[model samples]
Target: MALIGIARLASESELLEAKSRVTYFEIAARRILNRTKPNMPFQWTINPYRGCEFGCKYCYARYTHEYMELDVQDFEDKIYAKPAAADRVRLELRRIDRKDHIAIGTATDPYQPAERRFGRTRSILEAFARERGRHLGITTKSDLIVRDLELLREIARANVLSINITITTLDEKLARLMEPRAPRPALRLKAVRQLAQAGLVVGVFPNPIMPLLTDSERALDRLARRARDAGAQYFGAGPLFLMPCAQKVLLPWLEDNFPALALDYRKLFEHSAYLGSGAKRILRARVEKIRDRYGLNSGPLEYRPELWLGEEQASFELRD
Candidate 1:
């Protein structure tokens, strides 16, 4: 079949590595930074890789693979790394204003297994470290981020940097079942502690709070408490939203694991991707109460790095 756009590039990508069912490819990216919608919390977005290996059943990004003319399931099996990532970001930095917020790993985990071999995420971070003023954030479920502690510190010193570590539940068995290939809960928390100790702004997000499964007050409270104990400065969570692509994978997994909640889930997502207003309000109240009890901030910390050299003198309320 004839290919175009990302599909064409994916087809021509060089084979990097392959192990078992997972294969890695290196694709040249035309640009590194992308502008986000006006309503989004951040102004810019970046993803060092095209797919993630930590096959979370509820991942909404699976549809991105469809852009390559591949099956949504290929989102986990076929990973694409962008080489010369540092150079690309350095060149693109001039196009955007210094005040814009740049969020890395919006669509794909920057530190996924592919990053271990390709070092694309690290290269990008190194590029950011050289810049003096830019708002930056990273979200991931991997403890591998701790590997770049000093590098992250360098970036944090000169920029407003926030690190969001997503931990759905502290329950090991539940985490394993929900995010099959992700690191264990304890390891992720440990990374949080270590990063926080090094003076980086860190927070815990129990995102996609699975309804009927992990949305109980008890579950959220315990997670918030642990996050505070691990040195997290902020705690937040949002209810789950399922697009058709995610429902295709998650619905079957749900039926097999929690047969009792299968019907409830179908009815909940039948009408919309987001939870209803009443349910969302209740969940928000629960999370807010938990955050207050744990003495955690409700959102990203408004911090200005002491070493920042930019003339733009303003504190930032970093989000997204």
Candidate 2:
């Protein structure tokens, strides 16, 4: 088959039923590693799946589905699982320098409900367990990651691995409204506690902090306190940036749930996706104070592997 169009590609995908609400499509993958832009913290990223089932109203990654000529809604309703992901990732890792950082789940939740059935993320982790001296980070909102605890610990022994559990709020009701299909806030907190107890570097990320929803000092402070109590070593937050795709879903959601603030959100993001400088400064200052009070690091520490062969020696050997 030529795979001429998105429809053809989709039709060719092998469908697997995981749950009544979620469907998984197996697709052939050309590559697994993606080089990151300069501004991103990591050099490379790997997403074993495309489309997240969590269906977060404020999700920024919805734009990804547009690349495949699919409706934005497909980003949640239709999930794509890459076949041979573990083998592809293993081969791809050989091309990347071990010193470069690889971040998993940057675009999609690798441990979404589909993962339980497909086990693609687990396969990738098993491959990574065989490697050494690599800086790797995985982020998810699901407690299902606990299923891979032993494998993660094994990878941590030889590689620098950090697990980031994203908890948007401590309130279950608020979280359900924001991220309707994600695991409960308490479950994520428990995952953080378990990962920390296992001696794994664990952190809490409250990203896309919705203005007037989760950006309050008291809200963030309470979240940080809970994270600290759960044994998380770091706490980080970023204000929400509503791109066009996100706005399509989030605007209506705001109107239905927080009608009074809906217009404010529209006006704020009408011209630009990013929040204003003043708003960012206020949030940063608030987070800083909370982190300071909780004795939590601002972000995960960069892991740099020791260099056994000096650069000069390697260059000379290559020249020879």
Output the number of the lDDT-best candidate.
1
Cα lDDT tens digits for candidate 1, 107-161: 7888788888889899989899999899999989999999999999999999999
Q: What is the model-wide C-alpha lDDT for candidate 2?
A: 0.81
Which segments of candidate 2 are over 4 A away from where they belong? 1-8, 301-320
**Quality of model 1 by C-alpha lDDT:** 0.82
Could you estimate the TM-score for every candidate? 0.92, 0.90
Off by over 4 Å in 1: 301-320
lDDT of 2 at 208: 69
Query: What number of clashing residue pairs does each candidate have, in the order they appear?
Result: 0, 0
Candidate 1 local lDDT, residue 289? 90
Range of the 10 consecutive residues with the lowest summed lDDT in candidate 1: 307-316
